[model samples]
Target: MNVAVGCKVRFLNDVGGGEVIRIIDKRTALVKTFDGFEMPALLSELVVVEPAADELLQKKTVQEKETAEANRKKKPKSEVEYLTDDSPEVADSSGDELSLDIAFVPSNISNLQQSTFDMYLVNDSTYRVFYVLSNVIDDNHTPISSGILQPDTKVLVKRLTPEDVSKLIIMNLQAIYHKNIPYKPFQPEFYDIELDPIKLYKRGNFKRNDFFDIDAYIISIASTKREAFIRHLTDKAIVEAIKQKEKPAPVKEVKKPNIETEEVDLHIHELIDNWKDLSPGEILKIQLARFETALEGGIKSTTTKRMVFIHGVGNGKLKYEITKLLSSKYPKLRYQDASFKEYGFGATMVFLK
Candidate 1:
């Protein structure tokens, strides 16, 4: 049977089942096992468990909620995981069993202009959350407000700008917890979260909130926390990187004769020292090779705006060959007779564009 990503499937050879993460090809697929191991297996080696992933995802969410609620009564005070700002968003027991979900809801007024997106910090577990919201602006963290969020309650954290939506910045939440049967309160925890820019603008990202009676961006801080990694670079290096990105590449500069030489000489003797033993055909070949090389070099250069190739008035053969090559191969370059005051009718001046 043909399978697609996000479908639930069981391994034919193994006793375990998993969700299909990716369709590698016609014959292969990447499966994410229930035990969290992702492995590539042949399509024939898999059997469809659930064609729709939404059912599986809903079942998993309900199971987690039941588990979190059951742990609320029997959770130990000292038993806790070292929670950090940048970590996976797996809900854990902190003696009193607390779980927080940070969700962003966008304004969905049909004709609304410049939406002021709303952010909600929800307390899912049975404990009250004392929360503080801070905004990171211009490399500085500014405190917005602090309040106590009751159990199974949510509070508006802040309104976001479109500029803020596109950036990496998000509200930093620091909070302590409280419970009626708790031995001691849980320590303050840090969480960094931001709505995905691509998803934030999408109409599907927001759903009709029966509670709020409007549409909003709902970001779940349930399964994973955004990483708080920063890159360190010197000012000079940053400036150089910006310049490289914004600036177009410059043309290479070519070497040219000074005012004394006036033009490049393509004569056989000027091209090579040992030309006495060389045949006339070989001499002509060497002169043409040197002339082609000089012409290409001048064309690639920004400094050499105009250059003259002195091939001499020898039977007009060399001149005719150079003209034909320029017109056919190097059609972009315009060539004509050199200045009458300088080389007279012998040299050709090639204009480099």
Candidate 2:
């Protein structure tokens, strides 16, 4: 007899009746009862059945409600009184006594394995041993502990050799074929020696002729006239250090100053008195000079006020120059072609900052 996952089956014998939970293989089935205990049994020992009526009825009712809702056209009511007929208090406790059918199986323990430096006890009845292994142990070892194992925690079990058991008890040794093996100590690269130059030079710094050959240099210096070699190397090192100290620091780049001319707004009276008859270019030059003077004055005064360049609307040359200068030189100043009904396009408005 064969069973599959979620197959509905009932017990044939009286060894605790339940539904089949899963199929283990061709002959076995994992079954669970409504009371929550589970077991593996032969498929020949159970009978297949349709699902119970209570479950079928609940499913039918849900399907009917969904069908009704899908066919309906009306929008759902938002207010509680219109949406639901039941009182809030009765609705709250309606599902309190509902119980679900669930089952639990005994956890499988055969996959647990002993780790290096782990101990175990053998259970005589089942020929299986229970023991705590280091969580670091290989997965192949049997009767292993779950999660993190605490020191000195006794694990119950069976079916391991005495040598294997003894190896587990020894704290710092790896268990190999049921025997304890001591850990090897790691050695340091260089130990207990002074780095003298005479010893370095004799080791042949001249063979490779490489400047970065530190080890060869050390041996060569140490082998040859030791004191003189040390003094020469030390003096050379000092001279190199002094030369590095004498080298000049790098200089930072400086930005060039902007040389474009600025636009300035002259007083209406001043323009009439001293600048009215000048040509457009001459008037532009005067305006630029005035712009520089005004900028210096504003900076010194720390005031941000509007200055109106009252260039009348003749050919619009002066206004154009004024606006161009303002954009290039005094870009931070808020500028616009002056309002027509008031100053008209003949003047440009400069907002000082």
Candidate 3:
């Protein structure tokens, strides 16, 4: 009997059983009980429970439940043994091809414009395969479904709302397969599908497929005996890293560029493009603003020991104003006359604190 994940099954010898949560191998599977106990059991020892049987089991009374449990085989617990990968039964296959696809079947095919989707994974091959479907955004992988798919089986993985379908981004799938018996080695398959959210709304894009009855949008990651596409994961980033690794070593003593002096020309003409029509107050304001900016730079700079401010020896108003502001707002800074030979005593030098 072929089994897949999420199949409801019951223990043949035990009184009760649970749904199949994982397929361990061809002959072994992991079943989760109603009480949340997950135990390994052989596929042969567990029988699939139909939907009707589940309803009757739920409605059964305490006495009826006990009677049902008593009717099961009274075999000892020692008789149960889960098959391992090395077991003879784990060997089996679909000949050569192991294909799979991510399908999105519209809920209302007639009205595809406003319909939601029922997302599913279709394993077209005859080999039982394990798959993980996830969305990758901003380098983070979030799982949507992680389970085993029986050969030639399609499982409903998610019910996508219209909003979810609209914001669809890149998705990734990873899979590994096992057979009913030993078969030739097969490599793990991976895919990074860049989904076009707009395609889901286009009625003409949906085409008939073998796995689903409706015209569903399908993304085949693996086909025939090999992968349908290639993955160049972060190749650009890796190339950049290699380029940095191969860079030449720095010089033994790299010479620093000469930084002669830090100077500021607070002349109104240098500060603004069109200032001839401005008032004296506005003109002084612009000059003072330039002075404050230069002062801050001198104070914060590590290498600069001093800064020169060309206030010009016009009416000494600019010089007096600079001194007064420096004394009041910046007590740590000291000011003195700049070089009389170079600036004709027009510039003032401030000793950066």
Candidate 4:
């Protein structure tokens, strides 16, 4: 980014955010910090700020501070407890030892549309990991953060802007894993982690997880082991024994119901006596099964010509589902709305002959 005299800018990787007072060269610039100090910073690391946008950013910060202070003075209320490593339910996990992921925690969960995110490199295992996190732009990797992450912990790598979250196409995670004690070695991994920027816009994408105190969007980068193991309250670990392969079971042909009558009542109440406790989905499932069975049998019968399935009109969901299934699965079968005079817009008639 090109910088001119008296340009407002913020340092990308540092705490000091101020304005650019002088342009040193093409690659360097002199920035006046908020603390009244002139610091030589790289032009690449200086993010230019608009005056109006900067005002709004400062206002938002003040509002957040006020809200935090207000909450502190208010009457104390019971808070929901989330899972932590100290919790009894989170005992030392036996399987899937080397878990690794990059977690994105929203800075403002209430206002997700404009919220920034604190990105974290999480190492949820016993292995000491050396990782380099990079940003991939124009097929080139720009180094962002690199460190040795301790076992079962996470480090905040970068605080992402709203624009950064929206344009998050991809990131590169490079890592090598090892334990201090005697252990099996893992090959160095170079992961090109793909991300959905569109989904990041939704508040539901960030969730309260076992790792972070705040809700986060965690994308697992790698795990060193995939072997399944059983855990018990003993010094020894258990492994499943090898068993002989059993003979394959014979597949039974589904017996389709013979639709001998001119009409098949596919309603839940008619098909089953105990459907009062069933959910709408369960009811629809039963009706579809009955419809399929009758249709399959009707098409193959020699005498049966026409079949009318009475699926009552309730928001047209069942009718839409039935028609869509028939059209896609039985393209050759001719079907239409049952005679309105007889069925009153509640049934489908199929020509099987």
Candidate 5:
């Protein structure tokens, strides 16, 4: 690339561009940037910006060259001026306004029953506040607005309706504050405060009145001044109360019904009430059903190896039916007359396989 003095060129390895001032050697040239710093750059390290914007840029480059030459001609050369991004130093200021805080208060102190609740963001401390109020929904922090809050004053950010009160979520606050003194201000202090949703919006949850004239939610952010100790336990208790729901009582276990004794009475009076009104045939059928049920139970039981039925020697008809059922349905069973000492010739004991 052919280069000459007063030509605009860009630094190949760095961000900015400047005008070439003087060629030091075959490989190097001195360049001056717009911010007024001159440095030696390699000819290969710069690329000439083709078709420079106008002749005015070339004129400015020539004027800079003249200024550089005039400064060098002085008896004692002036010190070279370098540009940077740092602010100038200043002395620290002394004041009692050395802290910052964020707070909230209701606008109408006299009438607390208003439908539309007007709330204020109060800058309770002396330092000016630059703050952002973010609605923390889910895991995201969405900033509503950001601005400066003057000390000891309040800014109304919301005139909330009753529905707005319920729609309230977490308020994620981040702020940096410093005393607004002319001298070098105090180092900016950072604050991150998460306002509880219930306490921040729900009016019925207010537990104390020490910080405000009326019952209100006051958030304290890094303030050295003391206010009421927040009743976080109260909020916790309210949450617990809301979460408490009645749980159904645990189900009771039921026991399986089984034959109560080795000897089952098939007599109608023993099995049911008011058997005198039943016909003779109905009584016999009931007695046979009980006998069949008891025999099935004995057959299925692991521990019940024998069952004795006291059919009371009823004309031998019940016995004939019982014997027929055992022979046909339960071929694995055997039967004989029960003990004469206990049943007196009326009971029969059936044995299960």
Candidate 6:
């Protein structure tokens, strides 16, 4: 194979085509093409192909090259995945996972007046309604919309059948009522509503909200509620809240000591003298305290600036606490490890908002 620079070759596999740029070894050659790509190809993979005189084989224009470079420099947009179908699990910062158990109900049950209500079916015999009377209501009933429920309108709810309850659970009807129903709890009250005897014996004591209970009763209603109820007491939310609560507060950057031209030697000697007397821990503590003071000052002063915490490399406890505090308290600010010479491994820099 006499493939040399400028020789055209078609790759044996679907490796595409290129022009030879450098002969690497007896069996390998470097190829550079009009697409601005370079790759190594084995001699067996390349066939000595004749070049076509078409404009497609020409070198890229300066504008095209600039566009290609800009495109290469562009980064993909960041995405946050709140929910996924593959796994019904969500993770928090503390690495805990949570799942949602959702139930749906119909939108058209007319007699159901409460925006939210809890039902307790006792002994599979009695249907009791724990009615939470709120200002929220639907289009048909705007009792609370005028800031008061009409004294004449008596709000009543009926118990649903077993089949209706199953449909509500399957459809996740609570989400619909929560999103669509307009009711605010002014003085919520609980009441019990007994269903017919046949429905009570078949379905045991199942707890559900009024929207879900009513939707289950009116199965003929056709609206679909697509929201899922997120249990607030999950491990993930609790863990995250705990972490945020426990994390350390942000440290503010110190303004470099105002050194006039004549003060350079004095400043140098002061730094040197301080370094000689202070142990790494002492130096770190003093620096951390200074940063804290500066941070408080910045917040109080409403002045935003960069602050550096100078803790020298020994154990990184001070550094860790400083970073944790900044992340937890002032998450909007930017933070990073300090420069190598400034604090070695122990110091951190923070940009305050």
RMSD each, Å: 28.2, 35.3, 24.0, 21.1, 33.6, 30.5
Model 2, 244-276: lDDT tens per residue? 433465888876532232334453334334444
Top-down lDDT ranking: 3, 4, 1, 5, 6, 2
Off by over 4 Å in 1: 1-97, 109-113, 166-168, 183-187, 207-211, 222-353
Between prediction 1 and prediction 2, the one with superior TM-score is 1
Q: Cα RMSD (Å) between model 1 and the true structure? A: 28.2
**Which candidate has the highest lDDT of all?**
3
Q: Would you estimate the TM-scores of all the predictions?
A: 0.32, 0.22, 0.42, 0.40, 0.31, 0.20
lDDT of each prediction vs. the true structure?
0.63, 0.38, 0.70, 0.69, 0.59, 0.39
Overlapping backbone residue pairs in candidate 6 total 22
lDDT of 6 by residue, 89-191 (tens): 2221221111112122323333233222222111110111121222222212221101111111112211234453432221111111110112321222121
Candidate 5 to truth, TM: 0.31
**Cα displacement (Å) at residue 284, model 6:** 8.6
Residue 22 C-alpha lDDT in model 6:
56
Clashing pairs in model 5? none
34 Cα displacement, candidate 4 (Å): 18
The 10-residue segment with the lowest total lDDT in model 2 = 97-106
Task: List, residue by residue over 237-264, the lDDT tens digit for candidate 3.
Answer: 3334333433566779877743445788
Q: Write the per-residue lDDT of candidate 4 for residues 157-260, one digit (tens) a residue.
A: 77788887677567788898765344566676677766677777777778789987788887766654422221121221100110111135598887775545
Candidate 2 matches the true fold with a TM-score of 0.22
lDDT of 5 by residue, 3-75 (tens): 6777789988766778986665687776776655455567888999953445766786687677667746763
**Which candidate tops TM-score?**
3
